[model samples]
Target: MQKTHCIIPFEKNRNFTGRESELTQLEEMLFAGDQTTKVAVFGLGGVGKTSLVIELVHRIRKNHENCSVLWIPAINLESLHQAYLDVARQFGIRGWEEDSADVKRLVQEFLSRESAGQWLVVFDNADDINMWVGTPTEQGTKRLIDYFPRSKLGCIVFTTRDRKTAVTLAQKNVVEVREMSEDVATIMLQNCLIDPDLVNNKTDTSSLLKELIYLPLAIVQASAYINANRIPFSDYLSLLADQEEDVIDLLSEEFEDDGRYQNVKNPVATTWLISFEQIRQRDPLAAEYLSFMACIDSKDIPRSLLPRGQSRKKEMEAIGTLDAYSFVTRRLANDALDLHRLVHLSTRNWLNLRNEWDDRANTALHRVEDMFPRPKHENRALWMSYQIHAQCVLTSTKDREKESKEWYSLASRIGECCLSTGKYQESESWIRQTLKLKEEVLGKTHPETLVTMNNLALVLDRQGKYAEAETINRQGLHWL
Candidate 1:
């Protein structure tokens, strides 16, 4: 038997925890069929795709004595070219020392040969589709996909943040890396902490993991922070839950990891920013949708709440793009979309960094205002479904936005909805806000102002404040 030669760039992560099922499934797939195998492991940016793949590589090296391995960081065109050049040099491919030699082609040809033996090539961070498959107009350009070696004894693996890229490369043979289970996450958190006693308080440790959304990179980063600052898990959770900005700030803090690319930002908040920029450059509508989503609630987003694109098809396509990136997922019960909570916070920070928050917030406000239904009995189901999102938009509104007519109009509708549903106190609060805005913009005697005043009176009556309600009623009558 020929000896296996491995060229894995990173050492196996000693703190790697969980992922038993994924590792098993990958091993099964690699050895399943007689033909060459291709697999793509895809997920959200911080979900630990690379770490999972690294673990898989080490396992394969341990178990399969004849299986050689190579690792390529296919992050971009330049990196891909450089990795191929290194491969060519390592393989001692003919004429590789010459600048004129097609090093990528040389590496491809060498790997395709049966003399290369059973091998696996891992394309880590292969998120960009344009690099693998060139644009339609770039027919003359050589694509990275064209250079993939073909051999029955070889396998290919890709780790990416985009499912579309995964599908393009591996078809049905794809594994989606989702957030870790609580048990798995807890174990990983314990392994990562310098002081294992920090995890002794299981509740605080669990809360911290949940706040980080059970993402592996986030868990690692949080552990690093806690270790460095000598803070308890409870304190970290407090910072995370204090406010959106605090959460963003925590995720934005850079940390060092030996397993990660040195040049890449380690923070979860900024890591996905690369994918956001790519989406913006490739599909503007998808980017617009992301920005709009960031300004509202992260969960249970109704389809109608989003602004229409050129057509329904275009809108679905835009949504599809976001879905492909694992930033948003369709809920099983009602098909309503839910953005990942952490992605939600990070995207808002991204917009704030670019000074685009106000515009996007206004856009979200207008869309919800336009789609919010009246609180009629027949529209109860529809309005109820929209109620939470409407509240989210209102909560996201700034002080200046509170003065806008659009803001009050939505508030009035929500207030009426609350009234119809017997939420007397909540209804009173919304009505009060709406009435103040109306009174300021349209004066006390304006018909709209009177309508708002009447709504307030009705809410007060519901709450058993009959005297105050009657006083307002009499004042409205006097105005009339």
Candidate 2:
């Protein structure tokens, strides 16, 4: 029996979250005695697909001594070919010794044989479908996916975010990875903590887990923040509960993950930005819609809000382009859309880095405000859905008053509706939050901040807090 030939770049992530079922399912597919099994695990970036594959390989290595495991990356041809060279060096391929022939093909030919034994080869992050298959659209010389060694004695697994790529590479044998379960996510958060006792408060730990929406990468990142800053989960949650900048700053802060490449400094943003750039290059229209979606609430995004072309056909095609990569998901109930919150944040950060956030943010703010009616009795259904999306944009805008007047107006209207609906406390909370932000951004003397202060005092008076209301009024008058 030969030892495994697996030579992955990084050590296994000790903090791996729950993917037991996924690992079992994938393992079964690999060992099903199909030497040419082309199985794929596909999902959004940082969704733990790679971790699942790595765990499967680990199990196979430990339990099956006769099996040979080869892990290669398909991030690009250069990386793939370098991996091939490593394989050649590892296996002592004949022609590769003197570098007499093309080592890549030699390595492929060497592995694509019965004598290769039962092997499980993993192509992690096989993102570019055409890059593998060498389609006409691909720049320079195209290479068919057959470049990888294929043998009846070997099995192949691909991890990709592109659903179409998964289909192309694996046919019907594909598993769609999803976010971690709440319990598993909590466990991961606990594991990543430098001091487990720091999370002694189960309630706070559980609350932070839910706030992260049970995503493994985010859970890990939050834990990294906690460990590095020596802060509690509750404090980090407060930042997340605050402005978008807080969330952005928290996520944009980089930490090491064994499963990630070394150059990938920021896990959440850098990982997704790769796909975003690809989509932008492939179809600018899809890119535009993605940026637009990033600006709104990830849930219940209406088709009417998208950038539609001359015909509905064009609109569906644009949406399909995004769907192909799983960047956004469609909600059948309301015929709306939703996306991963991290994806939403990463997209905005992408724009902010490129200096395009203001353009896209302002566009979405104006459209949501003008298209959706104020929250009122006539059409509460439409207004409710529309207002949710509008609020998403409003909250992301910083204190730059001139750049966000439309958003401010919309927020004011929504605040009024909250008061009329006997949501006095809710209205007061909203007014106070905005007033604080405006004061920070526009200063107390700024006209908008004064108006916000007046509204906050009114809401306080309405709530029968006359003394507090008087103090707020006096502050506004003094600022004047």
Candidate 3:
């Protein structure tokens, strides 16, 4: 038998993803002084916090033979009490079951003993501070943190979505588990796909991983879908882009994880919906801001674009709420904020399920359209930040027909900016795209459509593609 008879059940497959740095950090914390023994791994739901902690569990059992380990589910007070009782039984503490003595208090004192050797206890999925610490009510007497056994002989690891609770529980020892690195994501994807592909397909595999946003849960889910349907990755990618509904459809399809995750079921979207609902309930503004962000691009969103001015302090604090939970990362250099791509899609889908997708999306588009600068040479620097965001938002939308018309102007402005900056190919592509949209949305002979056609021909001519340019100019002449 191993040293930890009461450890969390390790998955038989034993194929864990990245976080070598995190695992090492955890190992160091286990042996460090009192200031570091107890560590909290906190991040957005489905960001692999639990999986990383589970890996830590397996490592502990292997490296520290004298260490005692326990897994506790702190979903609520009752589960916590039950976990404490179970551990008490494992340690064989005297009279732990008796109503005469408090089981929690006794379990606490026993595990705090120096004889306990190097002990580690993991409290998984502690998503709520109120549940652990108990909000101000009659039951708020003792928090779960208060009952934890603290000793140099023992260490406690917590996995939570609540940063405040994490700070209160683990103090300075916190591991903010972010998304898996691209290389790690690629490895996970290669491992996840059941079907064999040609050796030359690695580039496509990397592309698909990027499309899945490098989130481990999303990557795993996509791979499972591919394997289950026996479909090629290319097909899944095509389906994924069919519409937001398709992405939602894929995300909501349930799969069995073979009991690896305790209560987190397979649907990647559902796992995040729980967090979405919680965020909505706790802070509606933050939730709205998230919804708005989903409408924008997922990267390098400047604080300048969000609601601002004299209320800047209040707005920043609201955004900070998201930063605290690892939903968005605030870049220190330019104060730009980036959202996880899957999280962005999931947020839109979360709203979609409620039939709020179009209204919300339209609102987001209008926000961007309102904020976007008109095509002018002086504002070129300002357009740089908004360029990618506009393209991302425009591309993510499935229904180009229902999109706000202002997007055309935005496109033209960005295209003109691209032209002036010597990005000829990009400029040509955007001009051609908007010209086509203008022909479709406004009839072929509409003055605006002719103007767009002329603009496209000009850019095409500028690119020295005379044949295409002459062809566009001829079509315009025929329409006029």
Candidate 4:
């Protein structure tokens, strides 16, 4: 595949992909003669947070022609301060440097002043939490957020991966971004790639593409690679199926013309690495937690189940650190703490490249199992909790095929845990759900599912529910 470097500006005429609702919500927030509202767009990296923000700016500029738009990337405190300086420069604030701090204060005050109607400031990618905790201007990134004066005349929007950051900044005004639907993905692919023919014929190609989870960065990388290589979409699919590492390697290849960004080392990979390395350096425990998380599927992780070495408290702290950096998201029970699949992939890639893949995975597995559900009648709640944790730990792991036995063991153990809890109905329900998913994804006869079925039947038999147990056993017998 040819190296791709320069990121072309998104086509204005092209249909904006996957954010119609978000745009509409933003429009509502900022609609009509300057009612000051702060909105935030936040999600995992590469979910197109920046793209969405850029597009929103264009829309706001075009439709609300009178409104001034100011954008600042808050990756760190200095960049945020520079943004203040830039805002000062834009306003032509003379002698602003005479009293820099006072000038900044005035700028904030002016922006929020009743006269500053129809102006919007977008704080893009404000991921760092320290930015929020300290004094808004003097200590950390928090000051910039605080600096944005609350005025009915002005509006602000922030984009970040950390839910906590969004809460700290915009609170109720935050919007969570999910993966794009097929239609949006198709539109995005069509617009981004060089070859129209391949996109037009994206029947089988689309199916293969879905496995990459429809993340904007992944789609962009895939489209760019396919266009540059002139490879048939089918061949590309074959390479992808053959090895994920191969696809990542191909993505990593750099284009000489584009210098760094255009090279095969995809933007997704590059930016993710920077975040990963930072987490590792600043918070090794969180880094370890993230590395373990990389071993599993990222879409839904249960916090109770994550591998947290010997110190449970320490693990929670580590998770907090990761959460602050927007590396990991805390779903907090309602949906099981979900991690972005792209983050999962990037983390695994980082671990494998650094030669810590096995160590991380094994440590995760060990610590996770240690926290697994224990079996006892009275402590059924505890058992169920542990069961959920173990499932999350196992599910979050990577290379399920290689760890088939471990998967089977974990699944079976969960089933056993459920049975022992005497929540027989709940046990049956849990086993049935696992079996249904396992049957569809892993197959009906996959040892894991079969074992779970047998366990479920055993639970039924133990409860003296012979008819139900017999029915389940009959099905398993056929599989055997």
Candidate 5:
């Protein structure tokens, strides 16, 4: 038996914490059979797919002394080719030294031999499928997948953010790496932080982890910031809570992480920004959905709230693209989609960076307005389900958009809903805003302005401000 030759690029993470179950599952699957096992580990960027794979490969090297291991970063053609060349050099494959020699083919041929011994190969960051399987028009060209060696003694693993790529690579043998559990995330944060005492306050620790969405990379980034600034968990949490911009600024702070790709930015925001750009290039409709979704509340988004696509099929495909990237998840009971909170913030920041925030927000406002039902007695159940989303849309409206007719209409509908539901204070606020706008744009004597005044008076009356309500009614009548 030949000695195991491990070719991992990154050192094993000594600070790696948790993911015991996932490690166990990957171990079992890799060693389950002799007939060339293949598994793909996939999830959102910065969810620790690469870390988990690294851990698994290290375990494999320790447990199987005779098995050779190879790590290839499939980030691009150059990286993959370089990794294959390195493997060729390690194996001392003849002719690989020549520029004309096909290093990939040489490595592939050597691994396919029966005497190559048991081997495990990991393709890290295989997020781009077109590079592996050429696009429709480029089918005649040789693809990266063609160079992958097949052998009964070999096990292959892929880490990716795109579920479609994962499925295409490994079919049913896919493991999704979700955000770490609270307990695991807390432990990881403690491990990452230089000062363990900072996490002594359990409440602050929990709040910090929750705000980071328990994603391993985000937790690590937060810990890095806290460690660098010599701040406590509460202080970092306060900064995160200050405002959306603050949160984005914090997540955008880059730091050195030994376990990650050297060329990649270590910030949580920038890590996911790569995935966002890929989604935009791969599926523009999904990109549009993401932009629009960023302007509204992140949770409990009814499918009906989305703008209509060219067709139902296209709409579902767009949503499926978002789901494939783990950016949005569907609720089992209601089928409503919920975007990850951190992803939501990152997306909004991305839009702002591109100077497209207002356009997307305006689109969201108009979509909500078009779909928002009147506050009629029969529409109560429907509007009730949409109430929070309506409020979110209204809150996201800029001062400039507040003057738009759609804005006034949505505001009035929401206020009417509030009035019908006996939320007198909120109703009065919305109706007052609408009345001010109507009076400015359409004049105080317009029928719509009178209607808004009447609604405001009713809300004031409901709140026991009869004197003010009577005065509003007289003013409306005098204008008429």
Candidate 6:
């Protein structure tokens, strides 16, 4: 499955592949029936998270006709608030204004009642962690979630990219997800093609498909282009292999404009970039957070690792900015905190393409290299904060893909510097992290993605984890 799996009929033709296990898990959690279940399914973008949930919601609606299934993409606090009000409207709450606290109270009251039985609410993409930082939208969806009735009849599901945020909200209920299977990817490609029989050409098609790592998003996009252009599957493969710009161009087609999702562009990458631009315009602090994220770990960004140099007011404002944009999310698990991988990836790619980022990529990398692990015996809280900064810095730029290789060379020099200074762990981590970003944004099939992949993989192999090293080797080969 590629990015094109997001297309409706195209994806449906393949009969909805992957995520069966996740669906079953959700069903069990929602149907267990004793306590009000607060479950969260989280993972990277394009890993079939939303699709699986959509399928689950459809099944629940069809089977349990009495229950009201509400789907809300809490893209931001305002969006989340709107979704809450929409739910209220569903219950025939007339005269309910979106900003009215009275409407919110009523929503809480209704859900609290025993009669609101077997209802399920999905807070999809509620990954923005900024929601909890300050003021915290006391009157809107956050309040709604906090106030939602705790009853066996009520079930709440949140899909997010931030594991920390999900865990914080649902605790042990968080379920992490991954990409689709190879078999499913092949089926999806075949079904999406104009002539499905062409999919059987095991030589070039299979080879190209494997290069995409069988990611649902990439596969779907590739399939749509191949079918739409009436080109041999091998030619499409050759295009992806030809140049970084070509792959980016190929992924940016308008394939998923199937009515309901008119706003979301095709290739998944561009659609995600709009959200990135939104964050930048609506919230500079959040945009900065995203820029910081581009140069970081790209996963496992702990809240405690964030920079608190800002005064409490500034901190709150920054957190609020991110929450309002739905760019950074936190999962509250009694006390634990986590960030989403998808948010990180989207932000990194967004920054990578911005000609402006090239100017600061080196400085950002140096900042991260300077602060990792913190000074002396760090507490878990401080460790988390440092890691988050490190991740943000790592993700903020792509020295490898710049018009000049100076940034990449600078990164290499820094890594070697760290290594010579007996900070081999930091050196290796920085190199590997930078390499991964280059591969994703600069093109895994391009020299930059491939070279960094090789450098990082070899570094990893030297430190053991040969299996991990081998995986990187194969990833680089896809570029070849």
Among the numbered candidates, top TM-score falls to 5
> CA lDDT of 215 in candidate 2?
71
What is each predicted model's overall lDDT from 0 to 1? Answer: 0.88, 0.78, 0.76, 0.67, 0.88, 0.62
- Minimum summed lDDT over a 10-residue window in model 2 is located at 135-144
Q: Write the per-residue lDDT of candidate 2 for residues 1-480, one digit (tens) a residue.
A: 334576766666676767888888887787676457899999877777888888788888888777788888888878877887888888878877664567766877877877877787889989987687755443443364756677777888999988878998999999999877777776787788888886678898888877776777777777787888899877888988887777777777788777777755645656788899888877688888988888888877888877656677767777887887777888988888887677887898899888988888887777777876766688777766676677677866665633455755677767766776778987886777667667766788999899888888888899899999999999999999
**Candidate 3 lDDT tens digits, 340-419:** 77788888888878888677776666777678887677887688888787776666555753344877766777787778
Task: Order candidates by TM-score, high to low.
Answer: 5, 1, 2, 3, 4, 6
Indicate the residue-level lDDT of 163 in model 4: 69
In model 2, what is the error at residue 277, expressed in angstroms? 1.4
Worst 10 residues of 1 by lDDT: 134-143
**Candidate 3 residue-wise lDDT at 39:** 85
What lDDT score is found at residue 406 in candidate 5? 95
Model 5 CA lDDT for position 52: 92
Which lDDT tens digits does candidate 1 get at residues 1-480? Answer: 445567888999998998989999999899567767999999999898999999999999989878889899998777877887777777767998895777777887888888888999999999989888875333444567887888888999999999989999999999999999998898898898889888789889778887788899999999899999999987888888787777788888889897899988889999999999989988899999899888778888878778888988889889989999999999888878999888898898889999898888988999999888778898788899889989888888788999898899999999999999999999999999999899898899999999999999999998899999999999999999
The segments of candidate 6 whose C-alpha lies over 4 angstroms from its true place after superposition are 1-14, 94-101, 132-134, 137-144, 257-260, 271-349, 364-480
* TM-score, model 3 to reference: 0.76
How much is the lDDT of residue 142 in candidate 1?
A: 55
TM-score of model number 1 = 0.95
RMSD of 3: 5.5
> Which parts of model 3 have CA positions greater than 4 angstroms off?
1-4, 34-36, 92-102, 134-140, 162-165, 193-200, 331-333, 362-366, 373-375, 387-480
TM-score of model number 2: 0.79
Model 5 CA deviation exceeding 4 Å by range = 1-3, 135-141
Residue 264, candidate 4: Cα error in Å is: 14
Shift in Å, residue 242, candidate 3: 2.2
> Candidate 5, residues 1-480: lDDT per residue as tens digits?
555588988888999998888888888898577678889999989999999998898888889988999999998888987898888888888899996787777888888887888999999999988888875333343567777788899999999999999999998999999988888888898889898877789999889889888998888888888889998887887788778887788888988888898887879887888889889998888999999889888998988888888999989999999999999999989889999999999998899899898888999999999899987898787888788888887888789999899999899999999898888999999999999999999999999999999999999999899999999999999999
